[model samples]
Target chain A: MSEVRFGILGCANIARKVARAIALAPNATLYAIASRSIQKAEKFAAENSLPASVRVYGSYDEVVEDSGVDAVYLPLPTSLHVRWAVTAASKKKHVLVEKPAALDVAELDRILEACESNGVQFMDGAMWLHHPRTAHMEHLLSDSNSNGIGTVHFIHSTSTMPTTQEFLENNIRVKPELDALGALGDLAWYCIGASLWAKGYKLPTTVTALPDTTRNAGGVTLSISASLQWDQPNKTVANIHCSFLSHTSMDLAICGSNGSINLKDFIIPYKETSAKFDFTFGAKFVDLHIGWNVRPEEVHVDNKLPQEALMVQEFARLVASIKDCGSQPSRNWPEISRKTQLVVDAVKKSLDLGCKPVVL
Target chain B: MSEVRFGILGCANIARKVARAIALAPNATLYAIASRSIQKAEKFAAENSLPASVRVYGSYDEVVEDSGVDAVYLPLPTSLHVRWAVTAASKKKHVLVEKPAALDVAELDRILEACESNGVQFMDGAMWLHHPRTAHMEHLLSDSNSNGIGTVHFIHSTSTMPTTQEFLENNIRVKPELDALGALGDLAWYCIGASLWAKGYKLPTTVTALPDTTRNAGGVTLSISASLQWDQPNKTVANIHCSFLSHTSMDLAICGSNGSINLKDFIIPYKETSAKFDFTFGAKFVDLHIGWNVRPEEVHVDNKLPQEALMVQEFARLVASIKDCGSQPSRNWPEISRKTQLVVDAVKKSLDLGCKPVVL
Candidate 1:
């Protein structure tokens, strides 16, 4: 493939953003887009200003089956991810499914198996992981200096996006049939993923949902908080809170024995091209305890391309490698995605079981 | 009373800071300091630059019985707070005690009873509460505007101060006989007090100690995390983590439905003269979810006196009202102190009972 041809599986609002990313990525092309309604697909393409050569399809099946389309980006609702992702994979198209990749780990397992059997690459659309800021943070957290952030002791993350009353009453996210996991799947996915990332993708020993949870009338969770614990020679704990009823905020703080990393905008940077995080090593009180001896250092990471575009570029790179080199799929992406989904499943189970601990 | 004369009990390191605060307070004076040894008391007075007129006593009983000592600033260890506080109060000296106040609520009640019988004012030494920044944040939280922070959803606080190996092994905080409550009393007291302040002093209905707790060989906790739940019509939850093993960090974030207040320095401000906190109301994502539409406003509060000095001044004002103006001792101080201790006892109970939830 001269350039990785991309096909979007839906005309969801998020698809518009990713379509632009595909157009910006040098190694990717917006080859096709599909929606349940032909007119909706055409309108989305026109509004997003897709190139004239791009094709439009009335059904998702047409896009997945298109031989020219080397990859499919599944931005469908959670309930449709398993069916559409598996279908896309079986059609020999690499899959970049948006998080929460599936309703639960079981559904994600089937999708991963389908991709493995078909020899197609699989990646979750957690765009933040592709950002340059994440790399800088990872470097600092893993630094071995005595003053650096030592062994991770705790991490806490939150993503709360407030929705209007009308949206709450009518949006697909709050509907049990559309996004069955609701806020837990849509918002908590990032929080849990961030926690796992802070811990270098190590799964926690146990997951416990806190007692404070809210659900819509349809029994879809609107808000939830859960904690994950790991015990060994050194103990570490992580807590995540996600809600659709609070003001918009995305925060992540990784506290270590020697230092800490704090970012108010973890999921999405406040600026498209630049991101910043505060890091502190061996902070102490000044004499007389009136002030700090050392203040946290704010580190800025600049990226030439937007994070979403970087995500597309990365996905296309893997696809090109596989098509040209006949290489097996990258296990890293699929493994991390599966682990994140497993934690989501455990959190849901803990919540369902009256906030009891669920051993993982 | 011409001025509130303060008697210092013991020569703990914290007492040095508080002694300076008493000297800086316009309406208070450091009249006496007592230690087990006359040499130690004299050395402390000389090292701290106490005035020549300030009396140095060989025993705490002498300071409490000194006729010129109008109040006692008891910076004793947690295990000794009850004995010294009650004795000072019973001698008709107003009591300003360092927190945890006592090991448990029962010990605090006896001190309160002694203060009531003698008509002496009582106040805990939570200096941050007196900071001007706290009042500003409180105003924003209680604002009724749609953009203001709405009803409380949760509060998360932490106070982690790293100690040297020598300090951890030899300090009174880790010694069971000297400070039995350990980090729970030394650090978590401020966390719990901050949470209660965020909720207008309404105690939580349940306190559950989280699973990640570290203890010394003497079975004294050195680090702990806990969740407090309020199950009224509008459910709320609060989490607090305190440790003596992590690098110094004091964080408090009060998240409400409409807005949030975040501060990295809540226990001790980064500066003595001024403090700042971030407040955001109804923050939203910009177009395409690339960035926030409204950034958090950094509100700075300046004070002429340091927080500790303000605490001393406030305590002295209450004492003066009772001694000179024929006013009743303020019940607010002791009431909130008792409630805070009650939650502390509950957390200790929960930690002792295999991390179970203890009903308030």
Candidate 2:
């Protein structure tokens, strides 16, 4: 099958990564790039070492309208996701948009609707979900044998990055005009998405923001903490903390009745070639409760391609099926994104309601 | 100085561990033990291979009244703590009580007042605090140099252990008559104590219980989640989850502006002689954000004595100081215990108030 041709909607910092991902994905190829200014797009292409055959456009509209492009990756600001993603989907180009899919689920719904109407695939840029390590962990979580971590009881996750004073004041992520939701959207998305993914995409019964929400001068969240509780008999509770003011930490821990899965660099691997997570099954205290009977076993999963490239390969595979075999777009990716967005919205509402829990 | 003779109040399962610790501490000795039944006390001594010099008594009052016993270790249930701890303190025997300190801060205060009035040293048995690794982490946390994880911003910890249906139905930990606080007291004590220790024992401004409180049939909490938020300029938030329903997990992660410290076995090390934690200092994403610039460095600390023995040695040293050097008892340990109990009480109040936030 011919490789899916990709067009990037913007020359944002994240676009550099996705552009490289497109080039590396065996089933995908970088076909076009764009920026508000043609010179900026050309500069991005040159800086990222894009092939000479890659076209540079001044506006995102050209990328969406391109006849040869099979997919458009939108690395635009959160506020612009709806406008550009809808445009790409309406043009029959599969949409791969940066996270915090939109400002809220309402805007994300419009983008989803456009994709459904146009028969185009829609997937958010959560590269970790595509990592082979995730699949390995899922196996352990789902296995009915002794290998599985039995019924999940609690999950804890965090996404935090230290920011410079200059970035906090001027970066698009912290700017209301560009991101709006700030750290809540930019960082918590990973934590919330991870919690949902750990629970097989089951929505929580309620979302409550903790009173520790810190805001920037423009009232955009700088840091936030929230809880998502699922009712019985799947009575699992997840705590999520995301901040723009802390040192780098991407931790995820899921505890179940018989075991637990833990990873420190969950959002992004410490290295691209392989990732490791600690899995402890049937852990119990030794006699006299002096120490654990068994220590956590480190499980390392090697991937031939980086997680982002794998994401692109998977997305392009769906695009190829739709284009070549007349198959429908995959609903799995869209459903995951939509559920994540709904929880994100609930967290925002809870924050606005003075941390009172918003029942789903 | 001569060894501080220790008397065990009850032959609970945990008492066996403490008896070994007492025997191991160079400055402590197991002098006597009582279990409300002379036969049970004798069986405990014989099963534990206790020294023939050790006295076996039927009543806790006999051990408290014995002038040869310089310190009394209370392994009694939460309901019996105040009565025994205060009696031991009034009798001028230094007290080393199991955690939860007491049913509440009010009951704990009676024990503290008695200790203070009698000039008997008081300390709770949170053995992890005495581990060399804890001191190593504390050094990093307090360091003014780049080695320090600057200005703490977040802490996440969990203390969970799987329980059998039989244990859940019959264990004293789940019985309201013996341990009304249940998991909140037995498990959360470690998590809460770890968080406060990470923050240098500073009290949080508010304690809010999440709506995920699960209770046993006797109205004892089987699982609970809560948040502790500090106000500016400290501005740190801690999330803690404790349960008897999950597999064993004792995780603590502290994130600051410059670094993070994470350990999966914070309360009790997987091994006894040496313990390790991951310290990620000055971490940042590599260019293009493909991976972290630096992975968490595993920092290991070794100790000659087991943590429990070290705890006993420290307690005995403090007792020896007051007995031989005519020095006043140290105020630090008692203060730490008081602050932890206060937070525990606040969480209980919040749970009772339907998971409302209780201001300090």
Candidate 3:
């Protein structure tokens, strides 16, 4: 289990953040950087003080075909998510693409076929799932005896990239196509993944999108909602909500037979910042004792072991597994890509016919 | 100044309550009883203590044609709602129909035309608007300064007969021809009307229904949701939620910028129910002092009057108004019926296409 040299694809803000964590990660090395501009890539590699043995590549494909690097991280635009990821996977290189992975399903299928046949790994980097509190929360929602939650109910989650007039000038996520994908690919995918993964259901049979088709801000839904059946227990139903128009602290809640499991915010890394878990159960007649019923559980931090750093370590380990064992759990590209594409297809179909049930 | 002699259409439970209220009304008098079965009408008239001077009619048309009866109250089955109401209106009598004025939009239009041409006042028995508390709650939402409700975000008003296994009955509101108007008509209509009237918005450009369909005794999702824009002081959007399957609080909230005004159980007569209007502007940040910059206020209420009595009084007053002026505010049958039909059509369309946006 020696370190697998990791080469960054593009110098995205998220890439920089991840690469910074990779530097801190044990058994991981930032081997090289590759960009469309060779000068920029070399500068990025030099600034990071990459090892003398590590070599920067001129083209994206060169990095994928590099003999030294074991994995390539693709933080490319959503539209090009599949193109490069599939190219890298087909070259027998393990790949980690950004959320959305592909704009639509066709690209996703190509990536799935390429990765499976080439004996390489392919996974979308949905960082929210890596957040430590997510698993503990999933357990609380899943346990029937806990009575902390009943039949799965409504789920709504929102995240905001807070900025002022000064920052808006430099912000690229606001550009229209990016805005559409940002709203869907950025915040929505997390909710989609969490809603499906935690509640144990697939993409909704029905969906809709009210993309802000207004001038200067096209292809973005200021707000979109769909009524859905999540196979609610006791013959009930569920709805998964996503929006990026406004920031809401209205976390996720599972209303159940006896009580409810209310999460503070499921996306953000609990160990990276201050976080707490809340659980409420009992009859509806009883008033919600804000923080009373919730057992005050501060996400315990190992002073010496950084959890986010550990997540990167785990990702590196996953990369090594693909190089050593031909494939890994993370490389189950067909399954993950299929689920991700199903959600994207549902949203797009909703936009076309107003909103309709689109089976995955 | 004299009482308008009113004829009871049938011996239904709702009709009984209404008839008793009419008997106690200062300007209205319950003078006769009518039923398809004359014997049943006589027994109903006697048990309800009808005046000895009043006559009993064997047929509904006979009751409509009787000069002795100044007005008719129709509380028949869903299919017969429009037929009987229109017949009585055509006979030059003021008509008050039960909860749902018509089973379908076309029927509502025919009923409205019949009433208008004959100069007969017609109204649906939606008395919740006349409640003082409901009116006051609406006023509070409109005020964002002292009241602190910023932007009215969403109002989820659910009144489901969840435990009542009455879906076994053949309800016209649940009919397929009604276009998924089951929940929209049966329950969500109140939420829709209350929100629409409160916000004073005439048109909703788009509507989408999520897997919107009809249900039977299994408690269909008359859970309808519509997002309408309120171009008030600030650009505000509202979600009026209504459902039948799940038990929801009988309340509405003015979810605003600074705080929220949750009208506690609007179904209870505002005069008799104890309710507290609270403002929680920015409760998310602990050290933020108040939720918003403004001082928060809490007004507690105690209902001293019988709750149902107010709607009864409003109906009686409207009855007297039509008797004097040939119409009342609630007697704008053309507008009500048109709006009802448009919404019903939209619901059906939304359901057919998985709640796509229906342009107004």
Q: Which model scores highest in DockQ?
A: 2
Q: Provide the TM-score of chain A alone for each candidate, in the order shown.
A: 0.98, 0.99, 0.81
Best first by DockQ, ranked: 2, 1, 3
Enumerate residue pairs that collide in model 2. none
**What value does the TM-score of chain B take for model 3?**
0.79
Error of 2 at A153 (Å): 0.7
If scored against the real structure, what TM-score would every candidate get? 0.98, 0.99, 0.62
Error of 2 at B34 (Å): 0.8
> Which candidate would rank higher by TM-score, 1 or 2?
2
> Which scores greater on DockQ, model 1 or model 3?
1
Q: TM-scores for chain B, in order?
A: 0.98, 0.99, 0.79
DockQ of 2: 0.89
Q: How far is candidate 1 from the true structure (C-alpha RMSD, Å)?
A: 1.3
> How many clashes show up per model?
0, 0, 21
On residues B68-131, what C-alpha lDDT tens digit does candidate 2 reach at each position? 9999999999899999999999899999999989899999999999999999999999999999
RMSD of each: 1.3, 1.0, 8.6
lDDT tens readout by residue for model 1, A129-238: 99999998888778465666888887878888888899899988889998999999999999999989988888999898988899999999998888888886477888
Off by over 4 Å in 2: A143-145
TM-score of 3: 0.62
